[model samples]
Target: MAQQQRATETKEALINAAAVVFGRQGYRATTLRDITREAAVTQGALYFHFDSKQELAEEIIRRQHTMSSGAGASFLASTESGLSSIVRLSGELAAQVLTQPVVRAGLRLSTESADDLAGAAAAPYRDWIGACRILLERAAAVGETREGLDLDAAAELVISSFTGAQFVSAALTGSEDLLERLERMWPVLLEGFVRDPDHPVLSSTSDLIYQSADRVA
Candidate 1:
């Protein structure tokens, strides 16, 4: 039992250390030695749990999606309106990028290692788009979407817009301005497809951004 617990701790330590290094140096530049030094673990210990750098990076991306998607699902479950949930979930994800190193690293690595880790890098975006599609479908059922709105296109647009917003924010300010960016994005992005351009949810954008920014600040 003690050995099992120690192994778990060591593996977790390696994952976290790798994430930090990957976040800073990116995937191609990061080395196993760097990860071991960051983790304060021996090479043998790291190899016991992970076969190579690629495997460690893949694990980080997998856990990143699990954490991100799990939170999105929770936000979806708790909110009453599909539109409202989408807004709130976007804020939460932006906040996570700033606050969670693993998430930030995973997202960064996904882009940096896209060619090498194509499937792992792409999975999170695909899942996020699917989640948005489900939310748009729900909004349509409740008459929150415009009469001629294409749910699939709307879903893709929302995810893609957020992706661009977050990416730009990260590059400009290390994501310090991410929530604010999302707040600015929603109005212009949602104006076309939402049934009501001036919904209460729309008006709450500033508050939502401020509140989430405060939490992650």
Candidate 2:
């Protein structure tokens, strides 16, 4: 039991360290030696768990998707209003991307291909789109969302818009401003999805979003 626990801890430390290094320098420029050094582990230990750099990158992407998708599934069903639920979930996801090196690295690596791990990188996006589609379907069923809106198209648009917004934020502020960016994004998205532009929920959420911005200011 003790040995197993130690091994688990070692792997966690290694992955966490590798995530930071990978986030700082993309997969193409990063090496397994760098990961081992960042992890403060021996090459033999790293090789024991991961045979190569591509394997490590793939695992990082897989774990990131697992964690994030689990959160999306868990939270998407808890609220009665699917639109509000998705907006709130986006906030939570923005927080995760800003704070978790593994998520950030996995996402960054997915965008910039260092190897043939495109499938690993694409998995999260596909899962997220599916999740968004489900949420929007629920919202439409409740008559809260736009009539005749294509759920798949709406989901894809949201995913792409948020990615662009997050990329711009990271470029300007080193990712410290993701929450603010997301808050700003909510108003635009709410307007796009809601059946009535003057819905009470939209006003309330917009108020909260701006209030946060003012506080930040």
- Where in model 2 is the C-alpha error above 4 Å? 206-217
Instruction: Name the 10 consecutive residues with the lowest summed lDDT in model 1.
Output: 208-217
| Segments in model 1 whose C-alpha atoms lie over 4 Å from true places | 210-217
Instruction: State model 2's lDDT.
Output: 0.79
Error of 1 at 70 (Å): 1.5
Q: What TM-score would every model get versus the actual structure? A: 0.92, 0.88
Clashes of each: 0, 0
Q: lDDT, candidate 2, residue 80?
A: 61
Cα lDDT, model 2, residue 65: 84
* Alpha-carbon local distance difference test for all models: 0.85, 0.79
**Total clashing pairs in model 2:** 0
Task: Give a tens-digit lDDT track for model 1, residues 1-217.
Answer: 9999999999999999998999888899999999999999999999999999999999999999998888788756764678877887887788788888899899888877899899889989888989998888888898888898988888999988988887788788877788889989987877877798777777786676666446554
C-alpha lDDT (0 to 100) for residue 188 of candidate 1: 82
